[model samples]
Target: METLFGILNNCVYGILALLALWGAYCVILVWRRVGQVRFADEEDQDEFLSELEQALEMNNYGAVSELCEDDRRALPQLALYAVNNRNIGYAKLRRRVAERFQQDVLSDVEHRLSWVGTVIKSAPMIGLLGTVMGMMGAFANLSSGDKVDTVQMASDIQFALITTALGLAIAVPLVLSTASINIRIRKMEDLVGVGMSRLFEALKFAEA
Candidate 1:
């Protein structure tokens, strides 16, 4: 029984390690994605918007499409969509662009974030399972013989404590990272909102 518990404890540790790696990867992916969707700096955003407005003012839809096509930022992508579908009129164009942006960009980010959330929730539970197995192993050892092996019992107790600690350690950092990532997501949304407003204004004039 003690040996079985020991094996299960090791398996739990292995699972936790994998969870940690998976969480880290998800966090990095979310970070990279948000960075890619947003502009590198305020200056770049300002420049792109200025150039787009100028193109729209000239009533050059081709220039607008080309400009947006060359840029990979979220706003530019949405702007391109808006320009391509400008014949639908502003009201429908605005609604469709919003839907597309939400479906394409934001939804993907959210899906990645959901994995991080899962790791955060699951890690602690897995750790607790390890702790339980460790404690059970220790108790089994204690009961197995007339002369108790103090050394083995101490090791089991240590394992239990370590698993609990490890679980908290894995979860806490991820919780903080998830929060930070969420803030960035919100900021991205706000910036996109502002950019879309500007793009829509430009489109109205260009179409007129």
Candidate 2:
């Protein structure tokens, strides 16, 4: 019985370790994504839009196209789409930008954030399961027979405590990291929203 409990304890520990690693990987993914899609300063976006307007007013299609090629951010890319389809009218171009933003930019940038959230929620639950299994094993050993080994029973209880601690250890940091990532995402969304609005206004002016 003691041997069986030891095996169960090891299994629980192994599972908890795997969950910790998964949580870490998810956090890393979120960080990398945040770095890639974060927005630039509002001033920079405003200046760029002003310059782009000047280029469009001058009928410099080449300059407008060049802006698309030179930049990788969502707003500039959306502007390129708008500039390329100048005859499509503001409403249609705006629709295009909205579609592309949802399908390409927002989806791509926020996909891994969902994974981070999954890990944040899963890690603690997994840890709790481990703790429950350990506790169950501890109690089972206690009721097994009169020849119960106190050392083995104590060890089982320790396993339960350790698993609970491990779960919290994985969960708490993930929660904090998730919060930070969410803030970054919200900031990025705000910047992108403002920038896109400005871009569309510039494109409308150019169309006029």
Candidate 3:
């Protein structure tokens, strides 16, 4: 019975280790993607918006299209869509650009984020499972024999506490990372809104 309990404890440890590794991978991927979409600095932000304004003022569809294509981020794509489909008229062009961005860029970003959320939620449950298993082992030894094995009981209790601690350790940092990523995503959404507004202004400039 003790041997069986040991095997189960080892299994739980292995599973938690795997979960931690997966959480780490998710963080890395999210951070890299956020970096790509975010402006490098205040100067870069000013320059990018300034250039867009200039292109719109000059009624230069080619330049706007080129700028959007060159940027690998989210906001620029809106401009690309706007400039490329300008002949379709503003309302239809706006709808198409929005649909395309929602389906593509937003989906990609959220897919990775969903995994991070899953890990944060499940790791604690997994730890609780380990805790329960450890307690069962400790209690079983007390009931199964005339002479209780204090050493084994202590070990089981220790395992239970350790698993719970590990679970929290895995969860806490991920929660912070997830929050940071969410903030960045919101910023990206704001940038997209600003870009879309400017795009319409440019269209009006062209009409004028």
Candidate 4:
């Protein structure tokens, strides 16, 4: 029975470790993704927009396409889409661009963020389970016989406390990271909004 309890406790620790790793991985991926899709600095954004607007003002659709073609940033990708479908009226183009950005870029980020949230919520519960199991094992050892092994009991109690701490440890950082990532996500959305407005204005004139 003691051996079984020990195995169960080990399994719980293993699970907690896995959860911590998975959560960290998700957070890092989201961070990188946000960076990729958004401008890193205002200067870079300004430069890119200036070039794009110049291309548009000159009625140079091919240059506009070339400008956006190789860039992975969200704004450029959307610009490429607009240039490709330039004959579509501005209103339709605007609507479709909004939809495409939401569906393609934002939705994928949101999906990954949801996984991080799941980890945040699950880690604590799993830790509590480990704590409960540890306590039960400790009490079971005590009641099994008058000859209680102090060392074994101490180990069980330690396991309980450690699991509780570890669970909180996993969750706390993720909570903070998730908050920061959310801010970045919002910033990306705002940047995209501003960029799109500029792009559309240029497109309106270019199309005319």
- Per-model CA lDDT versus the true structure: 0.87, 0.76, 0.84, 0.91
Number of clashes recorded per candidate: 0, 0, 0, 0
Worst 10 residues of 2 by lDDT: 33-42
Estimate, for each residue in 97-159, the C-alpha lDDT of model 1 and write its tens digit.
999989878998999999999999999998888788778878887788668888988888888
TM-score per model over all chains? 0.96, 0.88, 0.92, 0.96
Between candidates 1 and 4, the one scoring higher on TM-score is: 4
Error of 4 at 135 (Å): 0.6
Predictions ranked by lDDT, top down?
A: 4, 1, 3, 2
lDDT per residue (tens digit) for residues 79-125 in model 3: 77677778898888888988988887778778988998898988898
The RMSD of every model to the true structure, in order and in angstroms, is 1.2, 2.0, 1.7, 1.1
Tens digit of per-residue lDDT, candidate 4, span 1-208: 8879978998999999999999999999999999999998667888999999999999988898888999999999998998888788888989999999999899989999999999999999998998898889789889987899889888888998899899999999999999999999998888888898899888887767
Cα lDDT of model 2 by residue, 123-156, tens digit: 6777787778777877887788778877877876
Q: How big is the positional error of residue 158 in model 4, measured in Å on the Cα after superposition?
A: 0.8
Quality of model 3 by C-alpha lDDT: 0.84
Ordering by TM-score: 4, 1, 3, 2
TM-score of model 1 vs. true structure: 0.96
